[model samples]
Target: MTWLVTGGAGYIGAHVVRALAAAGIDPVVIDDLSSGHASFVPEGVPFVEGTILDQALVEDTLRTHGVEGVIHVAGFKYAGVSVQRPLHTYEQNVEGTRVVLAAMAAAGVTNIVFSSSAAVYGTPDVPLVTEDLPKRPASPYGESKLIGEWMLRDQGVATAGSSQPLRHTSLRYFNVVGSSDTSIYDSSPHNLFPLVFEALLAGNTPKIFGDDYDTPDGTNVRDYVHVGDIAAAHVVAAQRLAAGEQVEPAYNLGSQNGLSVREIMDAMARVTGIAFEPEISPRRPGDPDRIVATGELAARDLDWANRFSVDDMVRSGWEARRAAG
Candidate 1:
């Protein structure tokens, strides 16, 4: 059973495709290359260049690839930037999800693994957020992701009691850093790992936003999971759905023990051998002091594990970036 991965050329999507291949599952890629690179798609894999907004293209990809399931990852992912581009975010995330579901229904693809976000729980006052938190999304991106989850829920309800009911799950995670393969790395300008690495490479010190936060080291703390672990969990979820095992509507892939910006900077310095203190900048509006969810549920079902340390994340990310050239 081949799985179609939308946005398979992007960093996280590319990693998912690789993990699927490694697990001996066949994967076909469809990427629009809006924020992804063509080179990131593994050689010999079927690559279809198209947007998830194109219902026809998505349906064709599913049919042509003999796909039984989908791992949807395509979206406008930058939360900070999403505030300035709310319309674009909704179009890409909410409308794009609707299009994908429509195509899936048309193609009779009953199973899907959605690449959801931690943004859905923006600025939660609670410590160690659980899967059942009150979703007070602060940005359009988060709201769109929540709306996407709602679409999946409504579809599942609409298709219930069928011979093959829609089996779907969404994974929400924070700070997805590190790389499983050095050939493909995070390139999002909004991500911390890439932004810091790029600044260092350009002979500029990386800046840490908001050092006055009421946390350890006076910086924001977040759950920074390894890309490999994240990909593995996605594959596990897909396998569970294929086996007809019941799954949650949403699962948080996070770390109970999170990392801080200062810790990340220290690791980057040690890994890259570029010892320079990061400049502290004012907090971005709507940025929370700390946001880390509990991965107890994922660890139980999806085999979620934080196998990489902060140093591991920094080293792998740095190696991939320097090697990309």
Candidate 2:
């Protein structure tokens, strides 16, 4: 059965598409091209360029492609930008997900793998967060995602008695970095990896937003997982759902290891052989001091393993960025 991958032409979405292709499954793509690149989509896979907000378009694509499952990844994803454009974030993330679910119910598609975020956990006092942690999003973007999850949960409950009920697995990710290929490396200016890479390419020092965090290095710490590994988890989730196995509404995907901002910078310097210092500033509002995940559930359930280290993530991103130049 074919799968529908929203935002399939984007960085993480493109990697998921590639993983699906590698598994000998040809998934169809629907993207509005607002943030995704057309070139990133693999050849021979059917692609429909449009917004998820367009319910008719989404339903038509699903029906035309005979899609049995969906991997939803289309949405606005910048945490800092979401603080400024709360309305836009809600519309794209929450409302857009609602539209997709409505279309899925209309088209009789039952299985889905949602791309959620660790931001839903907000700034918990605990260092390593688990799937069961309390969700208290600090930003509009995070709240939007939590709302999307609620939509799925509520919808699932409403359709429980239906012959074909919607079965979904929402994967909450923390700092998805690196690239599946050079053509689809992150184009967003907001993410740390891309921002630093762009600054270094322009012969400028990358700026660190905060240096007074309680972390050991006096910088923010995050769980940086490889994009390829994230893609693999989606694949496994899709397969499990299709196999008629019982699945939960959400799971956390992360490295289970925290990497400090300074550590990332040092790794980049080591990989690219460039010696440059980052300009430190006060911590941005809504920014968490540390956000790491306990990915044990994903590892046990999906057989997911992060093969790339911090150095590998940096070097792969460097290669992809240089190739894009």
Candidate 3:
């Protein structure tokens, strides 16, 4: 009943830990605090301070906690930065996943819920991305996430005949926003929500990267899902794996709808009562015109849905960020 949540001190992983705990499952944490806050780990949850890249530490933690499964969420997540620091991304994501699998094999753990990314699809020309889309990762971060999924697949195949075959699933999505808990806010400097919040809090207008994309608002369109919804899906995925139920290799935790940067800016102004036009700048390279996915598979299997509206997402995240100050 005990599960290990890697990077449980981080924004997304911390929400997953809380979700698992609320579901009557014991959750253990192993976070290096590289991009995570120590205070984000709940007071009662058992936490080990270490990196997943360290096989010895990971194995020891798993054995000590009697962890039945692992929710692998630790990694370098900045897509833009990953292009500059590909080595670090691969080491933390690609090689790190391999090490986790090796440790799982050594520790006899047979289940995993991988935190994958929608970036694996690159710039999809389709209206809504599906699970079967051909992967064309545009950045090292995306490439690493795809590789991590592959490792899980190959390991599952290799262990199919064993006493404890691997039960795994990867959940992919873009633009995870909002906060499930006021105490565990998103602290990622690269995320859109936090960046706008930071600018508004500083009495500065937020800048949109570009407003010339082929969309209704001329801003790039992307999927945005609340963090609570994202965390709830992970809990369901873990439970399904634990129950020996049928599961897909990957699922997109996406909102069928897409939102533009201008829409988000409007939401921010409305929610925060900060009425200021967003400054528009030239588009950053590799910025895709549109990328959204269909969460039909996740909706059917993991009971996934976008429970929070754009205003709700903005208010909650803004409140949490302001509370952290």
Candidate 4:
């Protein structure tokens, strides 16, 4: 069966596209290139250059490609930036998802795997977050993701009695790092891995935003999962949806184990052989003490697991970035 992957040329989306191809499923790509690279798309995969916000373009792509399902990965993903650009975030993430669902309904596409975020939970007081935790989004980006999930849920309800009822699942991701393909490195200017790599590549010290959080090492602890594992879960989710297997409305794709900024810095040094200490900057506004989740639900259903260690994660991302340079 064929599946359409929105934002398929992006770092994570590109990895998902490759995974789908490896699994013997035909894949089609639709990306606006706002934060993605066309060169990252593998040769021979059908690609359409456009935004998901365009309902006509999305519906046409789905019908033209004979797509049976859609893996929606396109969105405004920067949480901090979303705070400053709330309107843009809402437009890209919220309105964009609405349009995708509408287009799916129009094209009689019955399945979709949405790309959600951990930011939807905001800063919970608990040590390990689960799927049932209260969603208190702290930023416009987070809020937009939450609204996107709601749209999927409501759409499913609205179409429950239709001949082609919607089947959907939202995978909530934590800190996604590393690289599955050396050709497709994380290029986000806001992500941690690229920030550290760029600083070291420029012969400068990396800076930790905060090192005094109430964690084991007085630094912010986060679940850093490899991008390959993240992509693999998407592939499995697509398969389950295509087969009409039951899936939860949402699944937390987390590592369960949390790593501190200091710990990440240490791994960066060990992997890249850059032996410079990271500067400890004051915490940014609205920074949380910690945010990590358990992937038990995904592990049970999507074959999810954090297979890569901290060192491996750093090494893969570092190597990919260096290779690009």
Instruction: At residue 44, give the lDDT of candidate 1.
Output: 94
TM agreement with the true structure for every prediction:
0.98, 0.97, 0.99, 0.98
Scanning candidate 1 in windows of ten residues, the lowest lDDT window is: 282-291
- Candidate 2 regions off by >4 Å? none
How does residue 134 of candidate 2 score in lDDT? 91
lDDT of the structure predicted as candidate 4: 0.94
Clashing pairs in 1: none
Q: Each model's number of backbone clashes?
A: 0, 0, 0, 0
The runs of at least 3 residues in candidate 3 whose Cα sits more than 4 Å from the true structure, single-residue gaps closed, are none
lDDT of 4 by residue, 62-166 (tens): 999899999999999999899899999999999999999999999999999999999999999998999999999999999999999999999999999989999
lDDT of each: 0.92, 0.90, 0.94, 0.94
> Residues 25-67, candidate 2, lDDT per residue (tens digit)?
7799999999999998988989999999999999999999889
Ranking, TM-score, top scorer first = 3, 4, 1, 2
Assess candidate 3 and give its TM-score to the true structure: 0.99
What TM-score number comes out for model 1?
0.98
- Give me candidate 2's TM-score against the actual structure: 0.97
Alpha-carbon RMSD, each predicted model: 1.0, 1.2, 0.8, 0.8
